[model samples]
Target chain A: MEFSSKLLENAVNEMSQLPGIGKRTALRLVLHMLRQPATQTNALSQALMQMRTGIKFCKSCHNISDVDVCEICANPNRDESVICVVEDIRDVMAIENTSSFKGLYHVLGGKISPIDGIGPHDLNIVSLVEKVKLGGVKEIIFALSSTMEGDTTNFYIFKQIQDFDVATSTIARGISVGDELEYTDEITLGRSILNRVPFESSLKL
Target chain B: MEFSSKLLENAVNEMSQLPGIGKRTALRLVLHMLRQPATQTNALSQALMQMRTGIKFCKSCHNISDVDVCEICANPNRDESVICVVEDIRDVMAIENTSSFKGLYHVLGGKISPIDGIGPHDLNIVSLVEKVKLGGVKEIIFALSSTMEGDTTNFYIFKQIQDFDVATSTIARGISVGDELEYTDEITLGRSILNRVPFESSLKL
Candidate 1:
């Protein structure tokens, strides 16, 4: 789209560089910012710059943090003996929102996607293996998405840790809560059946 | 959602304040930025800040510009006698893209929306009327949206310029090009029939 001003065009160009935002959406956003007070736009830009420059990663878990170690790793109440391995910090936020898991997380940054040129070395696999070999961790749960990349990453990590004295498992896959059985996909339905639990164990309080 | 870090939360909060962006989408965007190089984030932030702080408005038409007067208004080749009044810079860009109208533009900044606490006084209507009074203008075209607020703003401007020598007109409202007649609503269809052009005019190359 032709912009009336180069400044407007420049702002739109930068805004559209973001994932999922297009030129039209960027223009709309920039126009909206223009309509608001200059301080608001300044605040937004300041926050983004500050966050990008000042952000840190947890040394142990490789998750985005403001300190050397993330809050999850620093928390004494969380189970340090257990680590839930996932793809990125988003998954960490998702699992934390559920409030169901009390264990620490190990963010792999991304799964092993050979098609995308992302190998085991590209992720935090080496540090994870080192953490497992340190010998205190009792269990390491693979909480990655149920895809080919996820499975491959899980297998790779498992092979590297098989010699160590640690238990490794993957999160169970099934129909989500509040979903109807008829609407569920065949693959998930079949897996849910094959991974069925005892009736007594299913009755969790 | 509970954020793992204060900086991440701050960035997400600021990003979500943009129009049409929600908390989840904001988090997704922030995470996407975190995955990218620090330079990309810095560039985006700097662009937004620079644009907001350095942008200028055309003194004559109130359209966004990098100069005291916009290029369109300063052009001697454009039809100075005819001014096309619009809501904002976006409308100016849209009309400019069409390459149909050769006249200059007068941006009202926004329409008269009482619900949004925006009135004629809040817009650049006074300057527009003053320009009309000072000009040797022959025609003033209203290219505002067909909403109630747009109509109200148009009528208010019309009242101010009705006594002037300039001929006042509005951009025609009708079924859009490439739109099926059957799928169109009755109001637009009826308006299209009522405002039909002559057979010869429709045959224009």
Candidate 2:
């Protein structure tokens, strides 16, 4: 892990500090930067610095944005009364890709992971609950993942806004659309069977 | 692959331009940067810029270095008479890790790969020939990978240096030390047998 140049070593060390990047990968990336045109590296560095300092969050949903409100929240075409609660912008993009929902989003930033010292307050739960309390929202759909932390966050939010006269529901859990029944995990298969929709409703899907 | 913020999108796009990084991975890295303290991203950006601008190569062997002469070439203890020619700095570091060779290195930067439009003149081959022609070098070992480009580069150098008094050799091609013989590839197993060294010579290890 020794390097001939201190500059190269320093660059590699800093790069390896990033998540999922190991020392070897850092070295490879640094060397690639060295091989490419200086402008390429300059552009990359400037872009990262500018993004870190200039990135904005939507005031409404706390999703990453270039302005006070994200595009999803700003769009009049999107159904504002039906808010989809998600963990981050990635989930927002995922649901948007499916084109299944025309609702606005309330990004929580991250789930309530107590083990990681992240509680409900660490996320955007306060803003979300306040929005529901304002009384325009009709349905709040929990679109967070089905992990323990995701479930806890969903339950905590539901408890806070339950008496506000807003309908609360969760995304359906089932085997993936194209997955085989034999390959479905036990818990997912069991839940799908237990919550099986009426045959006529399934036919609509 | 859409982004919520223009700054975030720019950073992710630049990041994804790096080898082996996809859009999803780029987004993940950018998001991680956003979650971290601003100073972390600043440090990474500064380090990369400093390394790119200030990095130097050894004037003697063309290896990446902090000064005109590299450590291995400057060291008084290393053998000045023998030289190991390698493809790049990574190979130099790999051989150094073995701690078996005591000679200095000549890094060619890359092999002669015509498919990549790289030629002998494009590499440090001319300087290597000049070094051999100067008559102080006693032996030159071709330590490049055993690929077609590597062999082509090796043969091209050998052709230029054949008239010189220096002896020439290449790294041995054989089964790895701890590898199972039964699983060894046929070409390597065949070559290992065909070029077998004496039993006593191996037993000396």
* Top model number, lDDT: 2
Off by over 4 Å in 2: A203-205, B203-205
For all predictions, the C-alpha RMSD in Å is 1.2, 1.3
Best by DockQ: 2
Give the per-residue lDDT digits (tens) of candidate 2, residues A25-115. 9999999998899999999999999999999999888899999988988898989999999998899999989888999998888999989
Specify the CAPRI tier of model 2: high
Instruction: TM-score for candidate 1, please give it.
Output: 0.97
TM-scores, chain B, all models: 0.98, 0.97
Candidate 2, position B175, lDDT: 98
Individual DockQ of the candidates?
0.84, 0.90
Provide the TM-score of chain A alone for each candidate, in the order shown.
0.96, 0.97
